[model samples]
Target: MQSTSHSAVLGRRKEPHTIIIARGDAVRHFTIRPWVATLLVCCVAVIAAGYLLATTYLVLRDDLIGASVAWQARMQQAYEDRIATLRSQIDRITSRQLLDQQLMEQKVNELIERQTALTERQNVIAPIVERVNTAPTGEESERIEKKPQLGTVSPDQSGFKASQIAALWKTRTESLNKTPAEKADLAFSTITKSLRHVEDDQLKRLESLADDAYQTADKISQALASAGLVIDVDYDKANVGGPLIEIDKSQVFDTRVRELNAAFRMLDTVKDQARSLPVANPAPGRPVSSSFGVRRDPIIGTAALHSGMDFRTGTGTPIRATASGTVVSAGWSGGYGRMVEVEHGQGFTTRYAHMSEILVVPGEKIERGMIVGKTGSSGRSTGPHLHYEVRKNGTALDPLRFITAGRQIQSYL
Candidate 1:
């Protein structure tokens, strides 16, 4: 009987547990396995952790956004405060020692504006001056380099010669015992005169640079024309129209700068065109076996029109493209075996003939000095050589003109 009672107790322990909810005369029961209860607790813990992580992410995001906005506002305010301080300094320098303070303020402000404009002009002129100093057109840059004043000063230091002017004015005005108004006017007059001298010097230097640029452009234009090609110097202009107003004499420096900039643009266009010309030798250090013109045919022994120059080279010597262009034709042709023809724009084309091996194919882009083929006498019976030709608008041109121009450009480059 005792054993039977012990077995009943063990069976109760193995069965699932019941969770009971009790109220006055009302009761409910929920049966669950121990493993199910454990799973429920774990799910509640996971949800609570997720909620905390999401809340943290939202709080941190708000903080970061607020910080970014505050940073921008701070920077903007700093810039405004700095600008205000500079204006206040200008006012203190102008209105501190004059009876007619209002009138002197206006005049001094105008002079300050002029000085500021001159200072900005100095920054613009600096690069142009440096370019002139370094430009390959030899002696002009040499002379400019010798002039110590042409080198650029710091932007703030340019045309702000207040201390020097103040000292000189104090000496001259102290003896006369000038009135405050007169003293202020005289001081401003001296500043204006000083700024004018600097502006005039800058204008003269720019004029000199513009003249030199135009001269270089002119020489390049002439050289190109000799090869029967003309470069269009007038690049496209931007759309611009405005109501005309009376010109201000104060704007003379700016107006001249605009004109000089326009001249430099033309010079740049000319230089680009010059670069595209066939101005490089196909086989450097090679002797010309035959010149372009009527020449005695090697096999037939009769005068024939030779449309190109022939450079004497050994078999398999490298032959390079004279200018950057696209290969218009390549491969074997009658009388000119294994030829590569390149079309450089502006109606100019170049041909390499008698090549034993063509390294480029039709429609391939080639850059200047790229090896296009190997030189060999493959057609019309001759020793190993490279036959090079320059043509414009389908008419053969003398290659010597281009070769000579190349030499001239090299001298400067």
Candidate 2:
């Protein structure tokens, strides 16, 4: 009986440990009563295995994350480098100084504005590419350049065709992450093709515009040349490349037009001014000492504003009308011996003071620069000098301002 019981105990122990892994009751329902304590030991082994598996996965996850971050950083750096290069190129092109100073500045301003627009475009497009690599396959990227059915391609033809030339060569951006690898390749290739197309179109247009500009400039320049205006055909130094690409003739001709107009304006202004006034010199040898306004007062103390310029001409120098007008007054006036006043319209008048002799009577019409009398020390009696005065609305104006170059005033004594 003892041997049989011992054998039974061994057999019971040998049976697979029945550790209750399922629950049946509210409490520890299926209580795992270790037949021989082996059942409890089995539970511990399973827990240990699970802990080891979880730890391994955590370590792997950290390493994968590190690599992904590194990739993203590198991509960002590359993109930045490209943007910087483009900006540099744009800057160089915009700073040209060869054209007309004013026009060049305007063009540079325009170029800077366009470059800013292009930069904004790049900023909008760059992030979309990065997100594509992280988006799941079959994902629709929010950044994809979906074109409206504005072209010849039908809706069915418009759908993405990884193998089609047009689809693979254009509309190549994606907004999703975890996208299929093939799509990325396709997107990049298409983008490259698209960029080349754009660059080519722009280059051709630039060339065409430049050609057109040259033709227009040349034509207008010929016209200006015939019209006696010279064109300045030059490019700015700061602008890159061999020449400026453009299509505007007014760019050059306008400058010449402005210059010509300015020159004519100056001539017109000069002609409008009265320079030589009429007066006679009583003394023949004394040159004009002082013309008008404050002098040494011939006897004052402080520096005073000289109202008119002086003409150092020999006495008896003949004086004439500075302009054509009617003599409004001819008589002796205080500090003015036998003076004559002439009125030139628009509220302007000329006065010849201290005249040795008044040749023209009051109300007499006189020609410009006409000899009016001899220079004399008749009034205020200083040596002979015509105290000629120009007045606009009765206010004394400068006589020198009207004096024409190379023409001396007077014919007296």
Candidate 3:
């Protein structure tokens, strides 16, 4: 009996528990031991915890993705802004470079214009200078030539120098700064200064030339005065008026040009007057036999006033008028046979007497060196000789003096 009771207790302890449920007219039953039930509860807890962990992992992954996308967008925007700023800077630099180029072009054009003006002025003045250098003033010719040593700076050379300076300035400006505006300003300033210097040099050269011309004209005037000739210039009637225009700021150049013109005009007037003077030799290459003044008369053999010079020439030798004039007498006169008288203007007259024949008529115009008569001893002479007389307002004067003055003036011409 005791063995039987212990077996039953062991069986009961190992026996599986049974559970039943009934709902909605359906019934179900399940039986499990303590170890199986514990396993089932553990499985349900593990499955629930897996579901919660999966949900949390999905939410966290989406949040991390959003944050990463937003960070990437910010980085892209920053890069674009940086690029735009760089482009703006480049544009500003380009515009400045263009402006600098334009300014350089303008400066070059101005330099060209100045060179042209200077060249024109030089051309106009060169001939006047040459005339001055060539003028002859008897003993003073040598001194006048040596008076003014005019040194001229060629306009071409000046322009070339200016170009060189501009090139050097450009090179230096380029080296100074990276900014285009600064470089342009520096170049402009340098060119302006160089141009001013060139202008000053040109002005000085022109003024010197003008001074030389004035001096030459003055010397010529003095020579004329010494020869008893005067140039009558009417300043009030010069007709120099003109409409007022913009005066050149370079006054020196304009003033020099005007002075040169005036000097040249004066020289021309003097030359013309000298040409019209009755001072030519009447008998060229002929020896004088008798001088004018109180001398022994060849015919009378007595001291008497020899009012004319005598040239010993054979008959039929050509006699020429000493000056251009109108013939007033072309026939024989008392003590003169076949005589010809010419009335030159300016209170001057010439007479040729003792001629073989008269080739000119009374009231006829005669030119200098024209055939007026032939040389012969027709009246008041002892042999074949010709008499020439020069008178100033009907007063007899020495023809030799007038001939000498003519020679001197001719040298200048």
Candidate 4:
């Protein structure tokens, strides 16, 4: 706390100061007060430091600016690289989505084609099914109907949409939170499985249809055999022609088609033969007076050799021919009055004896059931009756046999 004067302190610092400079051949000396010398030295030191600092700033300005610009460029490049990586990921996802869409569309198209083919097959087989059902009920009909049911799908149900499938896939993927590629792969697998199921069902239906066709053909063959006719069919004969490319290449289907063809051909041949064969009763709804065999003749009253059957009828009753044939003889004969004879094909012939009047002449064409004469007891008969005889190559046969055959075949025809 001692008080000191400002002038006294200032007076004490005013002390003498000295400086000297020497060159090679010259020497110089200078003297000054202590306060002045200190002020001068401080001023000179401040100016030198300022100049040095200004020179250093000038020298480093370009380098600092370049470094700042390079740092900014590096930051921008890093950002660009991040953006490119994100873009590549997006591209991959987009490509996978497109591929999945294409595959789904292809599966849908395949399902549609299979459905169309099944519909066509049904159409072709419907008529045959109806025909088989119309036959007489028995074991054969039961066998034909006892087949596996075919699985059917409507057009609307079979036409699966890509958008709908995609929606379903998206829903599942969202629930599982799977990656885009994983979702696409799972969706494709599901679609493929569904298509395979549909195709398998169609194939099974086709196989069933083929089996039904084969069964029908077999029945037809048996029916033809019952008619006493043989059908010789060439299975290798090609009745159908088309391009080499076939839509259906199944061996089972091909075999069934061939069987059906042969069966139909056999039926046609049997029908032709039935038309020409002699299988009609000459006297319908009439009682037989005598059977075809050795019997006592009423006129001779003895066990005479009887070669024909006789039907009891009133005089002038219509007599019809038993089969289609050409007239071989007509007019009167010794024991048979107003007799007529017909020569049918296949070594078959028929005779009508003891008729009231002969309506056919020699070499005249006649059909089965045609009115050929009138029934009467003529030369050697005691009562009104008809005499009918069937012969094969000039040998006598029982007329009753032919009539029985006609009765048996009537239902089938």
Tens digit of per-residue lDDT, candidate 1, span 1-413: 98789888776447788989999789998999999999999999999999898888887988889899999999999999999999998887766645377777788788889878877887888776666555555654565655434323434435557667887667796837987667777788877876776777677667766676677777777766676657665453456668989778777677767867877887877776776789889999999988999989888889999898999989999999988899999999878888999999979999999899999999999988899999988876468899899998999988988888876664333
TM-score, ranked from best to worst: 3, 1, 4, 2
Highest TM-score scorer: 3
lDDT of 4 by residue, 44-158 (tens): 9999999898888899878888998999999999999998989998998788778777875775676567557656655655565555556734444565456433344444445
- Global lDDT scores for all candidate models: 0.80, 0.52, 0.73, 0.70
Residue 172, model 4, lDDT: 74
Model 3 CA deviation exceeding 4 Å by range: 1-85, 115-224, 230-254
TM-score of 2: 0.30
> Best to worst by lDDT, what's the order?
1, 3, 4, 2
Error of 3 at 392 (Å): 1.9
Q: How many backbone clashes does candidate 4 have?
A: 0
* Candidate 3 global TM-score: 0.62
Better candidate by TM-score, 3 or 4 = 3
Tens digits of per-residue lDDT, candidate 3, 1-413, equal: 98789888776446688888888889888898898999999999999999889888897988888889989989988998899999998888788668767777777788778767767766765675576566556644665454442334355645557549988778877667656556666666766666666567656655655555455455555565665656564442476788878766866677866766775576567655655556677788889998889997766679899888888889899998877889999988878877999998888788999998889999998887899988887876678778999887898888776677667666555
Clashing pairs in 1: none
Off by over 4 Å in 4: 1-251, 315-320, 330-334, 356-374
Candidate 3, 370: how far from true, in Å?
A: 3.7
Which structure is stronger by lDDT: 1 or 4?
1
